[model samples]
Target: MSHTEQAMPRRAGQQGLWVLVAVAVSLALLAGCGDDGPTDLQPDAGTEPEVCGPSDVWCKDQTIDRLDLLTTVSTGEVREEGTTSGEFLTFVDSRAGGLSPTMSYSYLRFTPQGLTPVQIHDQESLGSTDWDLAVRRYTLRVNSGTSGPSCVSVANTPEGTTFASVTAVNAAMEFKTEAWFDTACTLIPDDSGLNGPLTQLGGFWAYTSCVQMTGRVFVIRLADGRHVKLEVTSYYEPSAQQVCNQTGSVPQPSGSGAIRIKWAFLP
Candidate 1:
């Protein structure tokens, strides 16, 4: 073949190779920017993630950059005891070193049927919006303010208002965040069992030496703006029920930290 003819064919082959490489580069870029890509890619700092789903419900607003450690924190097993009055009834074994000096919290998310346990126990737990509530023995915390960065908050009903009675969230009802500290940054203690520090659902259980349900119902506003009415039904198992009398002593004290709660979505 002539030299010019040979050079033309080689140039054509080189052009075809370049076209193939360009196509592959485009595909790789598309794949990297896809929705199912790795979570390591950081977005703008402090930028809130977009509201997800067709219903615009909960936002998977986990700030990957804010977390110092990416290790998976441990959690305990959760039990489903079925439903009660169109509400979900769940039993959480939150006995992670109950009353011990060093303890851990069990994180959980609310579901229509029951509570789904979320295993995130490290610094990443505070930055992730996957969990709605965290329980450590008697104390409880929601994902907001000092607790985390999701928009979860709570509003308490009247003194005698039952969970079933709270059909809708009134416009005047004030929503409060999970506050574990006061204005001076001092750690607020649950000394009175009434949550003097202004925690949203802190008063659900009262401790007068003996733990007992205060029968308080709270309407929790979830991250997606949906409301749920929740109440702590029992602190012990149903088989071994115990409550303090007029005095603060329990004659037959049942096993503690068997947290049982009943909750349902509100209108």
Candidate 2:
């Protein structure tokens, strides 16, 4: 029989098998060579706490804690005024241990959470006392309604005045105008009598001459660009003991009045 016409029965089933294998290899190579580009990933949302904004309802509704700054000056001491620290918050007795009005001023470091003391420069190099060398970190303003000086009202409420900075507060004081809404902003008087809702350093006294820090909200700004809204909840100890004596003398050590404050970090 001629070779061209000869039957090759074993090769019939596997006919075109090489071509099929080549096509399968080509497909596999194409898949392997596909563009495996970088994926666009995103960060997880809501990982951080939402900061309270100025107009947020939470700002008005949040409970204000009573922070006490005690009479004694030291670091990490929890008094009625708030936490006491020579670095973050300091009540500088210009009288060198005397707590007289105008004779005493305070330097507070305005952080997001609370107040701190201004940094003290080296006294030996400058030849000035620490109190003299210390700078004013922030200013405090007294917010009373247009009716003026209601110590009994709830502080920083929707009905009450809002917070104001030191400059605006001083302007309000100078112009005798309102700091928030129609609420009048009173300049803290230098008198030791604790009269007229005057903005004294550390805390303010009520019309009754008691260190009741209700309805007193202060808008304070720091040099480092922090603004805070704070209220004096109490200027007395938990036992209803006053922080400062009406006679302008320091309270007895046992009965010493501490500064109690309720504050919020503002945007």
Q: Among these predicted structures, which one has the highest TM-score?
A: 1
* Runs in model 1 lying further than 4 Å from the true structure: 1-74, 101-103, 193-198, 239-242, 245-247, 251-253
lDDT, candidate 1, equals 0.68
Predicted candidate 2 versus true structure: per-residue lDDT over 1-267, tens digit per residue: 766546554465466687788899999987986555333343334443333211211111111111111233323233223463311222322221224222112433344434444332211112111111121111133212221121111222222554333223232321121122212322333344643222222333433434444354555432222344555544445345333333333344432234445555555
What would the per-residue lDDT of candidate 1 be over residues 142-199, giving only the tens digit for each residue? 8877667677888888888887788888998898876555555555656675444445
Poorest stretch of ten by lDDT in candidate 1: 52-61
Q: How far is candidate 2 from the true structure (C-alpha RMSD, Å)?
A: 18.0
Output the number of the lDDT-best candidate. Answer: 1
Name the weakest run of 10 consecutive residues (lDDT summed) in model 2.
58-67
Local accuracy by lDDT, each model: 0.68, 0.33
Native-to-model Cα distance after best TM-score fit, residue 138 in candidate 1, in Å: 0.9
lDDT of 1 at 52: 26
lDDT value, residue 196 of candidate 2: 29
